[model samples]
Target: MNENKFIQLLKKGDEKAFETLYNEYASKIYGLLRSYLKEDEIEDALQDVYVRIYRGIKGFKQRSKLSTWIYKITVNTAKNYLKKQKKNYLSLDFNLEKNKFTSKENVEKDVFDEIDYEFILNSIEKLPPLDKTIIKLRDIEGLSYYEISKIIDKPVGTVKSRLHYSRKKLQKIIEEDQNEGNG
Candidate 1:
């Protein structure tokens, strides 16, 4: 079924449509929540996000894609969760499970790649929340600048510049870490 029709069903409080929507978006929203929340908080936050989505579906205007609207809701819910928890910092818990490589050469390469990837994620976790979020939305989640702008409620230009600046900052952090490790 088309998303519009699916959304209409959601608005009408159809249980099957709600189930389909949950199946489709739960994991993606959970992953997005992980970027903003802690392990203990994730399950609760995910529930809260879906609850809000279910209740707010009737008010959803089609100015954005359903995915984008869902993402925006998730971000807001995460921020609200953080505020409610009295936490001053947002942490990125990106799941970078190591891939199994078959050949010896591939195994060696993948080990080094995982090491570097882990290092970068550690560095990114040290960044301010907004920068971390932009980096995650753009690089990890593969969201477009426009989509990110809507999700974060910023202009497209702001999202682009923040993403650029965040990338540069992450690069500098990685370089510093490398230099210190070498030294």
Candidate 2:
């Protein structure tokens, strides 16, 4: 089942076609979910992403590849979930455990300490949403310019510029921190 046929099936309300599409991309979606939901299991997040995709597929337009559209939905949902978690975390009384935490021999390191793919992912999350999206879609996921342009609904030139800017910004952040540490 190719993208065009899958999209047509989605438009026509075919459950089997939807299942086929979900199965094909579930691993990619699950990887994104597992990264965002570090507290959760891969299978659990996979189920949630599929539920969201099923609910969301009807509103999808065909201008972008079905994969890109699905990825956008997955990322947006993850952001929303994170926001809610942050809000809940903030409401907790951290002061009660401040002394307890400080007394422990904490071993957490700076996320930017590494100079590899995981460090890159950590740094990318620190960037603005549009920039993060541009870098991830174009550089990490390796979507073609045409595909990213369609998914972002931006001109190809704009996508190219944003990607370049995002990479430069990340490089500057990492380099500046390293220089500061060594100095």
In the range 100-173, model 2's lDDT, one tens digit per residue, is 11101112113323365444555566676667666556655567777777666689999877877777787777
Query: What lDDT does candidate 1 reach at residue 156?
Result: 98
- Using lDDT as the measure, the top candidate is 1
TM-score of every candidate: 0.79, 0.56
Best-performing candidate as measured by TM-score: 1
- Model 2 misplaced stretches (Cα beyond 4 Å): 5-20, 30-52, 55-61, 75-115, 180-183
lDDT of 1 by residue, 48-148 (tens): 99999988999999899899999999999998988898886556767534332111223233433544566777887878788988877776666788999
Model 1 scores a C-alpha lDDT of: 0.79
